[model samples]
Target: MTDRASIIAVLSALAIAAGGAALGTAGQVPQPAGDAPIIIAQATGAQATGPSAANTFNRLMKRPGSEPNIQPSKDGIHDPANPGTALLQWPSEAFAGFPRTNDGNRVDWVKTLAAGLIRPWTELEDPEAEPFLMDLTIVRQVKGSMPNVVYPHLEHTQWLDCTNCHDEIFVPEKGANQISMAGILLGQKCGICHGRVAFPISDCRRCHSQPKTAEELRQLSEKSSWAKQ
Candidate 1:
């Protein structure tokens, strides 16, 4: 095998092993300190580096989209390009199983699954649960054209307990943490989970869930000006 192919094979093996551990332990696999080993592999070409070398080795060992011949089905199963296969087995090819939205972008899996699979609060033990139904909109503009983000606790809570985030990665109070794309890229804030195990940060629209209309932008600007007073 060529060096690149060898590298990819090794990486794939690591990913499968890590995926197994994550599944066995209910997704509690340990994280690497400093830069994640995958970042190092992408940067330094997989040479040994410090104590993280073995951790990185184990971590690296542990750790796309688009187009024709792919179709999204309501049943969540797609006819694989290769016949006789059960399902598309790789994460890179997962988009083939979902429908596109009106704007022609792939549907966000979290939203799609949460809509179909999650039970409504009224069906749960406590219909009126404490910390009652709080959702937040992160309105900071990272760029002039980027959309504002809508974070729904409703979706996240279905899978993760509150202690997963509260007072640890994030404070419960609003505006307490200064979140930035730069910090996230370095594995801080949302980056702690995202880009590591969760959906990658590359899909900008996933978190930037709400695109603003021109009138809405104008109204938001007006509100900001008032808040500055």
Candidate 2:
């Protein structure tokens, strides 16, 4: 395989091994440091440096409406010569009226799903098949002062199957895996979908929804069982 493809395969394997360990098992994973700017620290021990690091992080936070849709002819991807391409609908028009976000095309997918505007089929061949939606939520405490992460299984499971994450991207057991911001930016763990197909981590509030309570902070510092987990 090519170098790029090989790298992807390895990351995919690691994600499967490490990610699944945080679901429901009694073990707990350590949290990474947080920051106002897009934190790019890696669990792999690589450090981000250089003066441009700040600018680079800011630039990576993509804003919606950066690329406007024009006639297919003028657009870069399509062949203007092809009449069929012109007939295709622009993404702006296609996604019109959908919920919006602060970044990345500005589409609020979770709200869109909750609104019942879209009903995606689970299986192409079996139209009768339905998605198995779970209502569980997993909370991961952050390492520093940032808000804790609230992972709602209902939101994700509504669209994906248990297998989509369980054995591959994340392990099903709790505290078995260690997740880091750096691993995610590299497309490991949650990065497999986030920042790529799903919402980008630039929207810090999206995942870091729960704020830390004073008691929680004390427990974390004291190295409580969950903290050591």
**Cα-lDDT of candidate 1:** 0.58
lDDT of 1 by residue, 93-178 (tens): 65455644432234454665655533345446786563334455445444444687777777576556778888899987767888
Q: Stretches of candidate 2 above 4 Å error?
A: 1-65, 68-75, 126-128, 218-229
Per-residue lDDT of model 2, residues 1-229, tens digit only: 2344457767975775677565433334354333334344324332446444334442344222124434456555688888798788787776788888866656888898789777777899997687888999999977877899999999898788898888877777788778999999999999999998798988889899999999878966777566575
**How does each model score on lDDT?**
0.58, 0.73
TM-score of each: 0.41, 0.63
Worst 10 residues of 2 by lDDT: 57-66
Best by lDDT: 2
In model 2, the Cα lDDT at residue 11 comes to 97
Give the C-alpha miss distance for residue 182 in model 2, angstroms.
1.0
